[model samples]
Target: SDQISKDESMVGFVDDLQFFIDNRDGETVVGLKQKLEICGRGAAFNDAKKKKELFAKLLMRFERFSSAQQLFAYIMAAIHETFDTKIIPSTSSLSTQEIDAMIEAEIVDKIMAEIGEGSDHMTLNRTHIKGMIYWLADKCYVRWHCD
Candidate 1:
């Protein structure tokens, strides 16, 4: 994804990510897992192996960025929030485009800010955000339909 903006505060992005990874306590890890489980099952992809492969590719892309962990967390939180406050309550499935729009509305600005602060040259765009969302859906971190 192309960068939306840049900022000087991003100088220490690498350090911040290292610190985040190094200091990941059990609570934090559990919270991530819980977020993933909140929506029960995902129906985006029916083939488990294919989903795993796609997730692996996305993980590779995520690792190349300085604020990988934070970006992942933000998207996960946004997905969970979207499902909890929107999709699940509606008790109906949303088209992928609709889900993408909702998720993007919630995170794009925040993510742009974080991305600016997370790297000097690396950037993220809607495509990358959607990729992350799709991977999460495939992994059962969020759902498009109520279960």
Candidate 2:
């Protein structure tokens, strides 16, 4: 499930995540924060240039990985394993941008808020936004290169 589906590049970041989390010793903490700052740069869309670069890169990178099963799997994973989502809005109205936001912003915020600072709790749930979050997480964390 964590395998970036068909295109292995999607999971490139995921492979690095556990390693990054594991190696969080005293000295390397600053580097970790800096990497995370870069990791999280495109989140708010503050400037047009960075936002465009981020989206363009993602699209070019993930275009081939786009498939019905992958999308379904991503949705299912996030919903079932990661976060609690409410289905007030219908799927028909869902856009790529909104789904991206859920994965990039809301899920991380929700977990961080619930777990508090420096908490390692994996308190995820089956809710409305899980599906979107998983897909987005995979996109963010997974790499584009395959061995």
**lDDT score, candidate 2, position 107:** 51
Error of 2 at 11 (Å): 28
lDDT of each: 0.49, 0.35
Candidate 2, poorest ten consecutive residues by summed lDDT: 119-128
Q: Which stretches of candidate 2 lie over 4 Å from their true place?
A: 1-89, 119-147
lDDT of 2 by residue, 82-144 (tens): 332432132235554564465445454655454344212111233223323322323332211
- Summarize candidate 1's per-residue lDDT along 1-147 as a digit string, tens digits: 333232222333354334423332332223222433444433433443354455446545556454454555655567556656876555456655665566566655556655664344444555565555555544445444554
Evaluated against the true structure, the overall lDDT of model 1 is 0.49
Taking all chains together, each candidate's TM-score versus the true structure is 0.47, 0.24
**What's the number of clashes in each of the models?**
0, 21
Best by lDDT: 1
